[model samples]
Target chain A: MKKLAILFMMVGILIVFPGVLQGQASLKELTLSERTIQDPMKSWTITFTQPINKGTLKKQNFLIKDDKKRQVKAKLSLSKDEKKVTITPESPYKKGVTYYLYIKGNVKSGSNAFLNEHTVLPFKIGAVPKESKNSSGKTTTNDKQPASSSGKTASSGSDSKSSSNASTSTSSKTPGKNLVKVQTKKHSHFDEISVQVSDYVTKVKAGSNEFEYKGNNLFVLYQPGLKSGEKITVKGYSMSGKVLETKEVVIP
Target chain B: MKKLKGIGVAFILLLSILMPALNQSVSAAAAPRIDHTSPAANEQNVPIDTDIRIYFNSDIRGISSQYIKLFEKSNGTYYDFPIKTVKKDGEALHILPEKSLGFNKEYMVQFNGPAVDLLNGTYNQHLSYTFQTNYIDFYELMVVNEGRLMNMLDTYAPRQIKAFAPKRYINEISVIHKKTGSLKGDQASFNGITNIDINTKSEDVVNVHVDIMKDGKSLQKGYASKVTGTKASKNQFTFDIGFSNIPDFYDVRVTVLNNAQQTIDSKIIKFAAEDGKAITSFKESYKYKTAGNGYTFHELLSKESLFADLLAESMMQDIKVQVEDR
Candidate 1:
C-alpha cells in the first residue's frame, strides 16, 4: 500500500511540473528602483535586463496608474544605452496612494525579442502605518492626521463689526480648557500670532497658511504687510479634518 | 578816590560770584529735596508696575518705611498699599509695592517729612505725588517675523524668536524673512511693534531706536522715525532693525526714545542663531516696564525648529539655484 501511494504522488508531481514551468515562463518579473516612496515627488527608475529598443520606448509602452485605475500624467526619459528608463510624474502624487507602473508585453529589446509578458510594478506613496476596516469594508484611520489644507478655510466675508465683537468677546477667554486660543502680536508691517491648540488638534491654519500641531500646543504665525486692526482668522483642525476651533482675531 | 573806586568795583564783582556760591552751599547743606519724580505729580496713564521713583538733588538714604507710603484711592477712600521693599540706589529712592496696582486707579506716593540725605541733612517737607494708572499697558513688545525664511527657521512649531544653528545660512532666514523683493534696498533683520496705550491724547512723538549687540558688545544701531501720539486709545510704534549678515547670538536692544532722544522704555531680547540653541535672555526686558515678550519660546530648536531648519535649507537651496540661473 505504501509503494502504491508513492507511485500516485510521483504521478501527481509529473502532472504539475510542466504547468508550473509554463506559468513561470509566462509571468515576467517587473524591476523597479523603489517599491515604496516616502515623498510625493519621488520618481521611479525601471531597468531592463537587456538593452531596450529605442523606438519601443514610447509613452504608450509605459503607463502609470493610480489606485483608481486613472492614468497619471508622467514624463519618461530613456538612458542613452536604452537599458534604463526613468518615470517622473508631471505633478506630485497624492500621499497614501498606490500607483502601478505597467510595461506592455509588446516592448521589444534591441535583439527584437518581445518582453513576452505584461509586467505590473506597484509602488505606494506615503504609507499609512495604522489602518483598520470599517463596516463598509473600506480602509480607515483615526490615528493619522490629515494634511494641512482640509481645515475649514476662514470666512473672509463676515461683518467686521459682528466679527470684531465676536473676537473681542472670545479674546479674553483664549486660554480656556480644551479650547484653541490664539494671541496675535501686531506690527506695523507684519503681525505675529501664537496659537495654543487643544489636546486633540493636529494642525492650525492661519488665513491661507497652515502649520502642524506642536506637541507643546504652541504655534506661532507671522504674517507680513498686515496693518494694525486688520482681522486674522485662525482655525484648528483634528486628525479627520474637523474644525476643532476657529478664532477671528483683530490684529493687535 | 580812583583806587578806592576800583577796589570797590572789583570787590563788588568778586562778591557777586561769592554770593551765588555761598547761597548754593547753604542750599546744599539744607533739607533733602526731590529734583525729579517719575510719573511726576498728577501724571496720568502711568504703568501699573512703575516704581515709585523719587530722584533727589543729592544722594539720600532710605527713609523709614512708614514715611514712604503709597495710597490707592477707591470709593473716595485712600488705602495704604502693601510695601514689598524700599531701596535707596545712589540718588534715587525706589519704592516697590507688594502687589501690582490696579488698572486705571489713582495712586499717591508720600514722603512724609525728614527725607535724610547721604550727609544726614533732613528735609521736613511732606512731599507727595499722584498718578493715575493706565487702563492698558503700552509696553507690549511684539516681535513679528515672517516670510519663507521664518517658515524655514521654525521647523517644529512657531515661536517668538526665530532661532537657528550658528553659521548656518538657514538661521539667517529667521531674521531677514521680512525682506522681500531684492536684498539690494533697505532690509530689516528683525521687525517688531510695541503698543503705547494711553488715556490722554498728546502730540508728543516717540522715536524708536534699535541697537544690535553681539556677545554683549554693541554691533550697530538702526533708527526708526518718531511716531507721534496719534490716538488716545493705542499708538503702535514699529522697529525695523537691521542686523549684520553674520549668524551668531545677538541681543537686540529696542528703546523707545522720548522727544529729547533719551531712552524711556527699553527692552533687551536675546536671540540665538547658533547650534539651534534656545535663548533665555528675553526675560531681562522689563515686564513691568513694558508688556512681556509676546509668545515667549521655551525652546528654539524643538521638533518644530528642526522642521524649520530643514525646510529653510531646502528653500534656500532652491532660491540659490534660481538666483544662479538668473
Candidate 2:
C-alpha cells in the first residue's frame, strides 16, 4: 500500500509540474472576418478583439501559403493598445486562394499570457466572383448578371451551380464574413473600430453608388441591391486603420 | 515550486504588455515647437509692391482664411483677402492690391492669430505692420495729331505726329516761311512800286498790283481795306489774292504797310504760265506715273495731293516749339 501511494504521488507530481511550468499560454477566442478596405493592394487592417499584453507579446508571426504549401511571408506590428496587430503580407495574396495564419509564441493576452505556442489558425481569402464558367466551356452569362438583382438563379450552369452552392455553404458557415463590424460608443465624439479581414474600405460619394453612415446608422443614397446587415470593406489608413471615422459607404 | 513558476510566467507577460504604452508617451512629448516666422515680427518700411510671406520652422498643414487682412489708414477701413486667393511663392503670401495706394499714404497689414500648423495644431499670435507708399514719380502725356499741309519738298512730312510737351508751359510756334528770290537788277526797279504793267493775250494792258508779297506767290492784293484781317487765331492764317487775264509771264509789286500807314516791309513776286504745249506735255508725264494703265487720273491726283498735304501738316505740328518745363 505504501509503495502504491508513493507511485501515485510521483505520477501526480509529474503531471502537475509540467502544467505549472508550461504557463497558461492560449489564444483567446480569435474573431475572423473580412476587413473593410479601400485599397486592397497597398495595405489593410486586421483587427482582433482581445487585448494583447505588449510586454510578453513577441513579434507577430504569419505566413501566406497556397494549397500546395508554397509559403509567402508577412510582417506584423502591434498597435499602441496591443489589442490589435496589423499583418502586412510581403506580397499581396492571390485572389481566390486559401491562406493559413500561423501565429507563433509571440502573441499574448491582456494579462501578458502567451497564446498557443505551436498551433496555427487557418483561414481562406477570396473575392466575390464577378463571373463564373459553365461546363460547356463557353460563357453562358457574362459577369454583367447582377448578383442580387431580379432574384435570378445564382447558378448559371452546372459548374456555376456547384460554385454557388459552395459559396453559399461557406458564407453560412462563417456568418461574420458578410458583416462589416463597427463598434461605436453612444453619444461619444469618436470610436475606435477594428478590422479583421484583408479587404478594402472605399467611400461611395454622395449622389453616387455609395452609402452614408450617420453616427453608426447606415443609409444608401442609391439602392445597390443590398439588404440590411450586409458586409462592406473600406480601405484606407486612418491612424493606421486603428481609428477611422467614415461617413460614406457602398455595398460590397 | 509549480505555483512559483506560474507566477514567473505571469509576471513576464505583464511586463511585455506595458512596454509599448511606455514608449509612445515619450515620443509624443518630444515633438518640436514653432521657432519663428520667416518674415520677422513687426517688420516695417516694407515696399508697397512687396508680397507678404511667412514661414515656420516646420512644415505646416493649415493656413486660415481670416489670418491675413489689409487696412487703409486714411479711411480706417479693413478688408480680408483669403489665403487661397492670395498667390503663394514658396511660403510667402502674395498680396496684390485691388487698387494701388495713393502716394505717401500709410497702410497696415494685420496677421491674426489662429494660423495653426496643420501637423501640430499650434496657433500664432496676431502680428501687424505699418508701411507707407513711396512716390512712383511717373507722369506722361501722349499727343496724337492728324492734319494736312501743302509743302512738297518737306521730307519730314507725316500723316500723324505725336508730341511730348511739358504740361507747365504754353508752347509757341511761328508761321512757316516759303522761299523766294530777292528783287535785284531788273527786279530791283519794281521793288517799291505798288503797280505793275501786264500784257494779256488779247493785247490789252492791265495794271497788276498788290499791297505786299509775303513769300513766293502768296500775294497781298487790292486796297488795304479789301484785305480782310487775319480771321484765324495767331497760330493760323489764310488769304486769297485775285488776278485778271494777263500775259504768260508777269511781275507784281507790293508794299507792306503798318496800321499807322507807314511802310514796314516790301517785296515783288513773279509768276509764269508756260506755253500751252509745254504745260500739256508736263501734265502728260505726270499722268503716266500716277494714272496710267489701271489707274484713274482723278483718283491718283487726289491721293497724291492729300498725301502731300497730310505730310506737311505733320511736319508743322511736330516742329519743336520752345516751352517751359517745371
Candidate 3:
C-alpha cells in the first residue's frame, strides 16, 4: 500500500511541474503612476511588479516625442527598490505642448523576465487635455491664478455660487461671526473695536488707513473723539480678487 | 522853587519804592497761607481713609512734625493721631493714618506752635483744619441721565460705570468704537462702548492724572480728583469716554498718575497695528476745561463733533481682510 501511494504522489508532481514552468516562461507587465501627465512635466515614472536587476537593466533607449513626434532628450534612473523607473527631462518642457513617452519590453527584471509589452504614455505640458472639456467660460486651463481686481462683478445671474476660500493652509473662515459680540476696548481718548465677520475681508477702509490685508475676520476701527453713529463699509473679496460681498455698518 | 519841585518829585518816587519794600517786609513776616487743600476746609462726607494734604504759599524751612499734628476729636476730648509725613516743612503736608478713621467723626490737622518758613517768614497763628470723615463717594457715569447722554439706546444693559471702571481724567473725552459691521441677525451681545471706571478710594492716592496713550503717544491727558462730600462710599471716579473717532486698530494705554503726576499704573486698553508715524502727542488745541461744573469727558466729545468725521475718515484705513482661493 505504501508503494502504491508513493507512485500516485509522483504522478501528481509530474502533472503540476509543466504548469509551473509554463507560468514562469511568461513575463510580467509594467505600469505607470499617471498615464496622462499634466503640463510642464518635471518627471515621469515606470513601476515594475518585481525587483529589477541593476547589472542587467538597460540604461538607454527610453524615448519622448513632442506633439510633432520629434524625439526629445530625457534621462532615466531606477528607484532604490529597483521597482520604479524615473524619467527626468534634461531641458524644461515647453509650454502649451504635449509629449509621448515609450520604453521597449526588452527591459529585464531581477528574475531575468522581460516586460510583457512595450510601454506607452501620453502627457500634456501647459496645455488642455484631449479628453477633458471646460465650458464654464469663467476660468481656463491657461490662467488658474489672476491678479487682484476691483469693483463689483455685476453678474447677478443665478449661476452656481462658488465661494472663494482663503488661500493659506493656516487660514480659516471666521466662524461664529454671526454671534460675535461687538466688543469695544477703551483707550485714553479713543475706543478700539473688534467686529467678527462671516467671511474674509479683502479690503478694509477703516478711518483713513485703507489698505488690503489677508486672514482678518475681526474688523477693528478707531472712533477718534466720539459722536453719534458713523458708517463703516467692508468689502469681501475672493482670493482671485472678485468682490463677493460688501458690508456697511452704522455705529451710534 | 523849580529845583525843590524836582527834588520833591524824586522824593515821591523814592517813597513809592520805599512803601512797596515796607509792604513786602510786612507780607513776608506773615505766616504762609494754605492755597489748596485736598479736603476743602470744613468739607463734609470725606472718606474715612482719606489722606490729608495741604499746600502752602511759602516753603517752611524748619517746621517740625510736632508743629503739625492730627487730632481726632471725640465728644469733648481730642487725642493726637499719627500721620504719614510732613514734607518740605510747611510747603505741603500729607497725613495718612495707619487705618481708616471713625465714620461721622471730625478730625483736625492742628498746628501746635507757630509755623515758620525760610527767610524769617512766620506762620504766626495756630491753625487747624477740622473736617468730618465719611464714606467715599461713588462717581457715576451719566451715560443715560434722562436724555442727557443715552448711548445704549434701549439695549439690554444700561451704560453704567462699574466700581472698577477705568478712570478717565479728561473732560468730554469720548471713546467711540468704530462701527462694527455686525449684521441685523447677530444675536451676540455687542459691547462696543467702553465703560471706564476709576476706583477712587480716598484711603489711597488722592488726585491723579490719567493719560490716554496710543502706543507711546499721549492722546489725551486729564486730572482725576477724588470725590468728596457725596453720601455714598462706593464712589469710583469714572468717565464713560465714548469712543468717538479713533481710527481702527491702535495700541491704547490708560495711564494713572499720583498726585505728584508720576505714573503709578498703566494698562493696555486696546491693541492694534502700531503706527510708525502716529501722532506722537494729542494736540493740546482740543483740550476742554470746564469752569464751574466739573468738565466731563462727554462734553469734549460734543464740543468737537467734526473730529468724529476726521476719525471716521481715518478709521477707514483699518479694515483687514482675509481671502482664500476656492
Query: Which candidate has the top score in lDDT?
Result: 1
Shift of residue A87 alpha carbon in model 1, Å: 54
Q: Alpha carbon lDDT of residue B222, candidate 2?
A: 73
Whole-model Cα lDDT of every candidate shown, in order: 0.49, 0.33, 0.43
Ranking by TM-score: 1, 3, 2
Q: What CAPRI grade goes to candidate 2? A: incorrect
Q: Which stretches of candidate 2 lie over 4 Å from their true place?
A: A1-252, B1-39, B75-84, B87-108, B111-117, B122-326
Q: What TM-score, over all chains together, does every model reach? A: 0.29, 0.19, 0.25
Per-candidate DockQ vs. reference: 0.02, 0.00, 0.04
Model 1, A1-252: lDDT tens per residue? 999999999888878786754632564443321244456766665555445678878888777899999999999898786766777789888866878777765566666655544555566664423343333446544333211110000111223211000000000111112234677775533455778754344456765565422234555655555667788777665433555456678976
lDDT of candidate 2 over B1-326, digit per residue (tens) = 99999999999898899878777767644443445432234333223334445554445565665676766665565444333344444334455556534334566667687754435345466767665543211111011211211221132222211121111111111111111111221221100112232211111112222532222243335732222255433432222233321222223343334445543323232322221111100000001121101111123234654322222222112222111111
**Candidate 3 per-residue C-alpha lDDT over A119-233 given as tens digits, one digit per residue, 9 for 90 to 100:** 4444454222112112222322212211111101111122322111000011111111121234455543455555553222223444444331212344555555544466555
Q: How many residue-pair clashes does candidate 2 contain?
A: 33
Model 2, A1-252: lDDT tens per residue?
999999999889879786654442542222222211222342223333345556643433444455677776666676776544555667765655655454444444554434332323334543332222232334322211111100000112223111110000011111112124433221111111222211222122222222232211122222212334444333321111221222223232
Alpha-carbon runs more than 4 Å astray in model 3: A1-205, A208-230, A234-246, B1-39, B42-66, B69-110, B117-326
- Residue B155 miss distance in model 3 (angstroms): 30
True contacts kept of each: 0.02, 0.00, 0.07
